[model samples]
Structure formats: structure tokens, C-alpha cells
Target: MQVFKEKTLLKAAVKAAKSNAKIIGLVPTMGALHQGHLSLVKQALQECDQVIISIFVNPTQFDNPADLEKYPRTLEEDIRLLKQADPELWIFTPTAKELYGENISAEQFNFDGLEQVMEGKHRNGHFDGVGTIVKRLFEVITPHKAFFGEKDFQQLQIVRKLIDKTGLPVEIVGCPILREENGLARSSRNERLNTFEREEASFIYKTLLKVNELFGTKSAEYIQNWVEGQFKNHQVLKLEYFEIANTQTLEKINRKRKGNTYRAFIAAYVGEVRLIDNIALNNEE
Candidate 1:
């Protein structure tokens, strides 16, 4: 795998695109490679002739400075992991200074109502920062297709909006959520959890599964209360927010429509490490 720290070098590397008609794919990530990330890489490898992976812990995306500070960075190990995933992968690892520079500014996005619910409601400016970095990278790479995990369901939606608003000639492919055998969603922050906390964290996904089970029979409010109660029983898992929302629009769904797709969205803290997970409700079949 070839690693480029500078955009100029990466751009030069991508110059091969001019001569060849091979489809380019991008998997933008912030280091700390895991099986979940590798799932995205695998899909890209299957579909695209070439793939580019970006590993920059975007400062603009973090709402809390402490969260940003605690964000994992294992570049050497990440490179090793990527090599195992695909030896021919083109990896981009740019510094904050290199990507953002001293005077950092992000372009504004009008996501309509897509950015005002769930994650957006809880974390301020989170999607804006996400939009900024994603927009910049999409511009820099200009790939024919980009892969994103459905683990960050809201972010995946916002990226779709980014493509629409910016008119970028790229397809946003949403891969399925990769989970552990015990049901805990694979995440970089999983590394921060202690043994007990890691096990306790599995409840988040368990509750999501429960939502899928109870969707047609129970009210959205009822399911929400049950999820909160489940977390309350386990003090280690601090429940932040849980909502049953329309999958396409992400607005809270009180009553299920006959054909509308819905999903259960969740965010909680296992110790200090925050984790998010979601499951399709009516659409599971």
C-alpha cells in the first residue's frame, strides 16, 4: 500500500486516473482500523478498480475538545491493518495542519431537516464539522464512488445530502453495520472500554434488537421508554438518547406508516467512551 501525507502527492498519485478509465473508490476514516472499517474496504475492493483510504482525525468534526483529544490514533498499526485488508490500497494520512491549515473554515450546508434530529439534536455543530471534512475530501479525491458504513446512520444520510447539494459526481454507498458475535457494534472507541464496560455496552445493540421485535406491536414512545429502562438497569451504560425514526428522513415516527421504513437510533456512554448503534425496524424483512 502506498501512503501519501501531502495532498499534492496524493493528487499526483491520482493523476493516473487521467490515463486509465478505472473506477476510483474512497473510504474516508479516522485511523484505528477495525473489522467494521475493513468491511467497507472489502466492498470497495469488490466494486472499484482502485480504492483510496483517508486517515485523518478531523478536528472540525468533534464537538467536545476532550472527545477529540481522546479519539484513537494508531497509524503504524492502522497501516499494518490496511496492508492486511488490501496490500494495493492507497492510504492518505494528512496532519491537521496539512488538511485544515492555521485558519480553518468550513462551508455551510443546508441539509433541510435532515441535520436537526437525533445526533444533530444532541451534538451541536457535529454534522457541520462532518460536512466540512467530507466536502473537502470529496473535492480532493473526486472518486467515482465512496463507501460509508451504516453504523453512523445519520452521517450516512448527511453525506447523501452533501452529494446532492454539491452535485458531486460520486455515488455514496452505505454498507451494513458490522457487529461482534455478542451484538456490540464494532467501533474504534470499543478499544477504550474496559472488559466489564465492553460487555455492558452490548446492551445498546440488544435494546435495538428489542425495538425491531416490538415495532409493530408497541408505540414509538413505549419502545423508547423500554430502551431507557434497560439502560437504567445497567448503571454502567449511560443512555443518552434513543428514538424510533423514519429511516429516510430521520424524523421521529410516532405511528408506523404502512410502507414507510423506520429504524431505532441510539447513543449511550459505556464509561466515558460514547457509542452509537441503530437497527432497521419495519424494513428488516
Candidate 2:
């Protein structure tokens, strides 16, 4: 696999690939290769003639400096994993200076009211950072299709909006969330959890499953209260927020709309590591 740290060289290489009339697929990630990430790569391989994975720990997306600092940066291991996963995969590992130059600034992104709730409300400027880096990556790769995991459902939605707003000619492909055998959503941050905390973290997904099962019978308010109570039972898992909302607009729903789709969104802290998970409430028809 070829690795490129410079955009000029990466673009030149991608241009070469494009000259052959190959369908390009892009998977943008912050370099801690987990099954969750590889799933995107696997899907990309299935759909595209060529795949490129961008591994850059984007500083702009982190609201907390500590979280940014603690974010994993195992370049050697990441390379090793990608090599094992797919020998044909192209890796782009760019420095922040390469993408943003010496001065770093985030371009403000207004995703209607999508950016103002859940993760946006708690972690300020997070999505703008996400928008800035993903936009730059789209420009650099200019792939026909870009793959993202539905684990970050909100982020996936925001990215769809980004493509809409910028008129970028790239399809946003959302892959299903990969979970552990015990039901915990696969996340890079799960690495920081201790043994007990890791087990407790499974509660996040369990609660999501419970929400999905109870959706038809219980009211939204009742389901919210039920989830809050579940978190209270677990001392290590602190509740952040839970919402049963319209899947399209992401606004909290007081009553279930038969025609519209909805999902359960949850965010919580297991010890110091924050975890998020969501589940579909009903079939989207």
C-alpha cells in the first residue's frame, strides 16, 4: 500500500488512479483503526474500484484539549492493520499543518438546527471541526463515494448536509454500526476504558436495545425516563442525554408519527470516557 503525507503528492497519485477511469472510494478517519473503521474500508472495497483511507487526528473537531491530546495516534500499528486488512488500500496520513497550514481556524457550518442539539450542545464547535476537516478531505480525494459509519449517526447526518450545502459531487454512504459480541458499539475511545468500565459501557447499547423494543408500547417521555433510570442503576455510567427523535429532522418527538422515521439517541460517560449509541425504533418505509 502507498502512503502519502503531502496533499500535492496524494492528489497527483489520485489523479493517476482517476486517469484509468477507476471509481474512487474514500474513508476519512482519525487514526485508531478498529473493526468499526475496517468495516467502512471493507464496504468501500465492495463498491469501488479503488479505496483511499485518510488518517489524521483532527484537532479542530475536539472541543476539549485533553480529549484531543489523549486521542490515539498509533501510526505504525494503523499502517500494520490496514496492510493486513487490504493490501491494495492507499493510506493518507497528513499533518495538521499540511491541511490547515500554520494557522488553524474552523469554517463555521450551519446545519439548520442539527448542530445545536445532543453532541453540539455539550461539545461546542465539534461539528464545525468535523465539517472543516471532512470538507478539506473531500477536496483532496475528490472521490466518487465517501463511506462513514452510522455509529456517529449525527455526524453522518451532518456530513450529508455538508455535501448538500457545498454541492460536492460525492455520495455519502452510511455503513451500519459494528458492535461487540456483548452489544457495546465499537469505538476508538473504548480503548481507554478499564476492564470494569468496559463491561459497564455495554449498558449504553443495552439501553438502546431496550428503547427499540419498548418504542411501540411506551410513550417517548416514558422511554426517556426509563433510560434515565437505567443509567442511575449503573454507578460508573453517567447519563448525558437520551432522545427519541425524528430521524430526518432530529427534533425530539412527543408522539410517534406513523409516516415519519425515528431513532433512540444516547450519550453517557463510563468513568471518564464518553460513549454514544443509537438504534432504529421502527422500519423506515
Candidate 3:
């Protein structure tokens, strides 16, 4: 339950953990703690000797300034929530200035077209922001393994690529997307939804399920068309982008290629809250 707000202090603590032959795990997050985040923390505690959860709401990751401003920050509550899970947890809660310096911005990267579609296509410079913050966290925390939810499947892939490109030692572990009883993917943004809007948000997952159901029988084009049509008729959520892509390259699957794995990805806006979710079209990850 100890919190380190300074990077140097956190680094020293991680160094101590390493010197003690402890296996360190990292669960980097932007605060606004919920069951979904706690799920990652729980897994880290299970697999590693020690876990560090970074709760900084990274500024450089948001392409929209207002979105950054509106992003939730519940540090005290978050700490209490984490303490309930593990009283000995080491929490890194760095400020923007403390972590990124006075002139905060993202470090650009070439993920070999991995950053050029879906979330990247609509929101300019978003992944770079994500990359910058995540890279910084890896540098400071120095975990043996880092955990991320599969809700941001693209980000997870980019992080895996980041490890390859930078040759970082930490393993990137992708966890399942924890959802509400209605099937709405658990997200920090879910806090913004009202009771009714929250229920309506379940449509995003339901649509993804429909896409999965239609996979082998329907063409990629047909699934894409059907998804668009579903959102068009829906009165609640506005579909942003839906793509059926190979799990590896993330290239949109036009026609079913033999021996290729696929996944269904979707992003939609339920009011101002933009939520994203994905489902594996097959049994594979």
C-alpha cells in the first residue's frame, strides 16, 4: 500500500525488488480504478513476487485536449481500492511534470502500419501518446512482465511491437476484457454513463457477438456491411469503425484465407463516452 510519486524513488524501489531476486510485475493504468483494473492487478499478484501499478493519467496520450482534461483522476480512492487487494502493493502515482517534464508530448514511433488504422485512423497521435507513456513506465518500473486488457487489442499489439522494436525485457501479458452483467465492456469511461446509457452501451458487445456469429458463413464485406447497418438503425450507440482483421498483421480480412486467424473489432460512441471492444472470431487468441 506504499505509494511512490517520484520516478527516482520508484526506480530505487524496483531496484531493491530486483536485488532481492523478486519477480516484478507492472500494471500500468490511468487511474479511475474499477473492477477491470483490479483484475489485472490480481493476475500480476498471482504470477509475480511483487506488483507495481502506475496510476498516472498520461497527458500526451490524448489527441484531444478536452478529452485529457475531462479524463477521470481518483487517486485516493484508487489507492484505497488497490489496498483492499494487496496491502503491500507498490503504487507509482507520478504527476505529468514529474514524469514527462514541463513540455509534455508523445514520442512518435513507426509500428510498421500498426498505428495507421482504427483507433489510430480516427484519433491522430493517440498511439504515440500511448507509446510514450507506456515506454516511460517500462523504463521506470522495470517489471518482469506488464499486464494490459485486450479491450485495447490494437494497443496491446503495438506494445508487443514496442518490446520487439526496443528490445525491452518485460513480457506483455494481455488479459481478458472484463464486462458488466449486460455485456458492456468495463471501462473507466463507463463512469460517465447514466443508468440507461450504460445499458444501451451493451449494444457494442452484442454487435461484436453478432459479427462473430456471422464470421464463417458471411463474407468479411457482408459482416462489415451488417455491422454498419446495425449501428445505423440503433438509436443509442454511434459506430465508429468495425473491422474483421487477421490477428497478426491487423490488416482487414477481405476474404477468408485458409489457416489464418481472425478477430472482430469495434468502436462506438454512446453519447460522449467512446467505448471499444473486440472478440476472437475463433478459439485462438
Model 2 spans with C-alpha error above 4 angstroms: 283-285
How would you encode candidate 2's per-residue C-alpha lDDT over 108-133 as one tens digit per residue?
A: 99999888888898999999999999
Q: Give per-residue CA lDDT, model 1, range 1-285, as digits (tens).
A: 899989988887787864588789999999899999999999999999889999999887777899989898999999999998889999999887787888676556779889889888888888888999998888888888999999999999999998889898989999999998889999999999988888888988888887888986888788778888888888788888998888889989867777789888999987788899999886533
Q: lDDT of candidate 3?
A: 0.91
Query: lDDT of all the models against the reference?
Result: 0.88, 0.91, 0.91
Deviation of model 3 at 1, angstroms: 1.4
State the lDDT at 132 in candidate 2. Answer: 98
- Estimate the lDDT of model 1: 0.88
Task: Pick out the ten consecutive residues of candidate 2 with the lowest summed lDDT.
Answer: 276-285
Angstrom error of the Cα, residue 101, model 2: value is 1.1
- Position 158, candidate 1: lDDT: 95
* TM-score of each predicted structure versus truth: 0.96, 0.98, 0.97
lDDT of 1 at 209: 80
**195 Cα displacement, candidate 1 (Å):** 1.0
Q: Please identify model 3 stretches exceeding 4 Å from their true place.
A: 283-285
